[model samples]
Target: MANTSFLQLSPRAQRLLKTTQDFVEQECIPAEAIYFAQMAPIGSTDRWLVVPPIIEQLKAKAKELGLWNLFLPKIYPEGPGLTNLEYALLCEVLGRSFIAPEATNTAAPDTGNMEVLAKYGNQKQKDKWLKPLMEGKIRSAFCMTEPAVASSDATNIRTAISREGDSYVITGRKWWISGAGDPRCKIYLVMGKHHGSKEEPHRQQSVVLVPADTPGITVVRPLPVFGYDDAPHGHCEILFENVRVPAENMILGEGRGFEIIQGRLGPGRIHHCMRAIGMASRALDYHLNRATDPARKTFGKLLHQHGSAAHELALSRIELEQARLMVLKAADTIDLHGPKKAMVEIAMAKVVVPTMALKVMDRAIQAHGAAGVSNDIPLAYMYASMRTLRIADGPDEVHIRQIAQTELKRAAQVKDQLKHKEERERSLRSRL
Candidate 1:
């Protein structure tokens, strides 16, 4: 049985969380302007995929302070070995800033990829790609989502990976593959169908590690989210036209892609939910700051004094607190039990957090009126990113379906157990 009690962080986790909070507030948040300045000319040749100098400086500082690689639980010797719950708290703090995750080497795609490599990659694969990824020397992308199918259903993916003599030839077109547009992104964990119609649908897919520089691989374009390209870490459309990698590069061999995805996405979903909470909290902060401004008045009173505005703030607080608890509970479930056992909790959080975050950001944007949507504040971008979460990883409908089915099955089991208990009681009473 899962432990469904209050979770207490270890002394080490508490210290690390405190340290991370301090680092984000003091250093990461302050560096946003410089980061934006570097990313201002999104179409420029040099700036498009360039990591800002301030970010590197902040990364060096984060490394010096031992705040790097706090995401991986037990994979790397250099990692701090924090559990999912512990890392969720720190991830919330990092979510306040767009660049904070990469600064501390705890970013997504990389985090998921690192975990996959640590758990499944052979030593040679680890030495070639995972080592640099863990060290933050290079970035990586997960090529799973495709443009030709409804990717929410993994079985619908059409990318094909066929075995050749001493190598595997991968042929497909994938889009929304985050991090593929970056110059530093040197590797890709590509997911494709490995078996033909004869095989089981789930088992037919496989994941292979394709070097970004492999022949016939093309980065078609960087897809933008609500006009924001998220430069240096873009979601790209890529074409793998007969791209070939050594047969040894297949992760965990063929027919294990779905298994790897199950392991990878459980944590990834929780991490996204944790960060969404942080983003919503930051949006609330922005909203409160704007509303409480003494000079800003609406209907002959300060915005905060207005009844509707006040209610919005109150509602935001309540919703954010509830969403945070759900994320924490999901993280705890993943920590205590395996992902499979915690699937229901993860699905619940995955569905709730993003929706809640979008609501909070919408209110924040409304509160600020013009400045909210403008680049003057981060709310617009935050909203766009949060909006994407509703569809990314798995869509809301998919998670909702999963959670509902689990609940229905649980209800049926409860009914059966109650009936059995009643039967036993009746038999005992009759004997008495």
Candidate 2:
């Protein structure tokens, strides 16, 4: 049972939590090996086509059980009609099993991409793209990062979308375009500069919808993480050579890409942190069980009783729970005050959660002895993964800068208030 000493879910969320937890324990857990095994054939390729039949069966089962589209709000037609907080409980359960997310149509890149389209897309854009995405009939990729620039500084993005009569010519080389290699990935939402803008640095960029089959589009290769191909799904490097699309394909008008990213990323960022909390929790449990078990130890004493080992495990547990609370508090803030008011909390959680996950994973790995480095457990993968997250959605340095700036601003305000109070007190004394 979870330590409910800190926070409690509403009745609806409680029900959602139970349903998803049961689904993971029953369906997803049993099918993990099958899903991974199916991935073996496509190990060399990056297309996510191998599991459609299996996923269709799983999706059918999930939808029939009223478990479909648990990732979205009520505004989306297919969702279970839950708030971010409610959906977050379901997400945590799904996070426990990797297959559970896709099984319920809540997988990443797609989920984040769908969210952007849902908010900023015009009717034609929505009808053609958003509808298929929501239905899970097709997948999408978000093309923002590039190999040629410091992508962390989004304003440095050099991808060019130039106007040419009634069409736009897009030319750029993009890397880390996740889900681009999927056979079913029929669309890309590309972020690039709209060449006519002499606008604000943040406002010169625009998001355009590009069909996968568009002319002059080329997929160079897929990138691997820790030598794992991540096949059936991949992060691809692609070249857009004067790729032409109708000007109407632009989303939310020109210069609004940053705005869309701001809105889209708040939920996406928090969700990633939440899922990471689950991953760390799972790794800690696996490590603790392995180290403490009689068969895994020498000299007849449980490893949990070992001096430094026990302390590290205790620390990992505390860190994991602390990070989880931060994530939940961020979620609650977003739910209650909206993303605008919750920006500080969101940024802070992003910075804290992944770093905490990395620390917990490192301790878990050390406790595993040599087997930690091997694939025997998910610890090694989790560690590598958590480390990557420190850079994935903007590196830790950038986030720290934001956090510091926020703290300094608050401190300055406090200083000003104190000075004003002293002036008021002195004036009152003189009058008396």
Task: State how far residue 13 of model 1 sits from its true place (Å).
Answer: 1.9
lDDT of 1 by residue, 1-432 (tens): 112135587888777777788888889888898888877486775655567789889889989988898888743564678887888888998888788899998888899999889888899999998889988899999999999999999998889999999999999999999998788999999999975647788889999999999999989988999888888788999999999899999999898989999989988888889888888988999999999999888779999888899999999999988988888888878778867898889999999999999999999999999899998889999999999999999999999999888778789789999999999999999999
Q: Flag regions of model 1 displaced more than 4 Å.
A: 1-7, 75-78, 195-197, 417-432
TM-score of each: 0.94, 0.93
**How does model 2 score by TM-score?**
0.93
Residue 71 lDDT (model 1): 86
Give the Å error, residue 326, model 2: 1.0
Candidate 1 clash pair list: none
The lDDT values for all models are: 0.88, 0.81
Best by lDDT: 1
